[model samples]
Target: MTDRVLYLVVCGAPLAKRVGDGVRAARESGWSPYLIPTDAALPWLETQDLEGAPVLTANRKPGAPKRAPVADAVAVVPTTFNTLNAWANGNAGTYPLTTLCAALGARTPTVAVPFAKHDLAGHPAWLASLAVLRYAGVRVVNPHDGSSTALAPVASGTGEEVAKRFQWSWVLNQLQEAGA
Candidate 1:
């Protein structure tokens, strides 16, 4: 198998499909992508057709061999309002949150893409969380300003054309620099 990158999906129902599309694109580009869903998201993911991608459970321990740092970059696609708020406040209570904390601790470059209803996305709490995440060294990408959805291709260009268009390229460069 090709070396894989860890892709974490928080809890956006709409964003999951977009994320899956991005995963398909990334895999087509020759990267093995793995999905880890939050506890609140498992049931939904099970009901959807994810094209056979593996799902990591919330309760799984941190030391499993499969959990090793295999990717130079970790992307948190469609981060929900709750999860984003929790992460900004340093709450590592769930699998996705804990994994994110670990990745940050290890100094892995991360790209967090937040998705919420337009009103919620503009709320003060969400904005504050975005600021906090930036302060914590996480690259925060949003679907605004004509960027594509952070992970998936744009369906109608409603949101940003894509958040952090440079992300995958940056990650690949980082991996090359590390001689991975």
Candidate 2:
């Protein structure tokens, strides 16, 4: 399983700041993780220690060699509103979005942890988008308690606190259960 690849896709939410913890955990679990961050996530990543994993923030130049192995599974941590909607809509306009879209199309074992405030999650599009991903076989776990059945939206102004309490095991356990 040392060669198993896990694409740890990250977004701009405050939870993005704790990505290093995910990377380290992935390694400890025998997965070779590659960090794929959205442009918005770069700032948070700037301060993280990624356990020396490769960070693929942009698509490679045309004809350039592939930088990472094909993913055995994918985990999207701190899936932001824009990213979740775009991914559910099949809009691969950005690298991270493209990664997500491709992962879904490939039917890869996937777990998504959304970290959005209640106000933003109230948008009708949010529930619809989540349904879309779930129907497509993506395990959409609640960031609060890792529950797959119910997603409790984060309260406004509580993102930092939520990020702190997030457990990477929630995401990892889902992937493991999927036989990743």
Candidates' C-alpha lDDT: 0.61, 0.93
Write down the TM-score of every candidate: 0.70, 0.98
Q: What is the Cα-based TM-score of model 1?
A: 0.70
**What is candidate 2's lDDT per residue for 32-55, written digit by digit as tens?**
999999999999998778879999
Please, what are the lDDT tens digits per residue for candidate 1 over residues 23-119? 6665765666668787666665655556666777755557756654455556776677888898787789987887777776777777766666666
Stretches of candidate 2 exceeding 4 Å from the true structure: none
Q: Worst 10-residue stretch by lDDT in candidate 2?
A: 45-54
Clashing pairs in 1: 143-160, 146-161, 147-160, 147-161, 147-162, 148-160, 148-161, 148-162
> Which candidate leads the pack in TM-score?
2
Q: Which window of 10 residues has the lowest lDDT sum in candidate 1? A: 145-154
Clashing pairs in 2: none
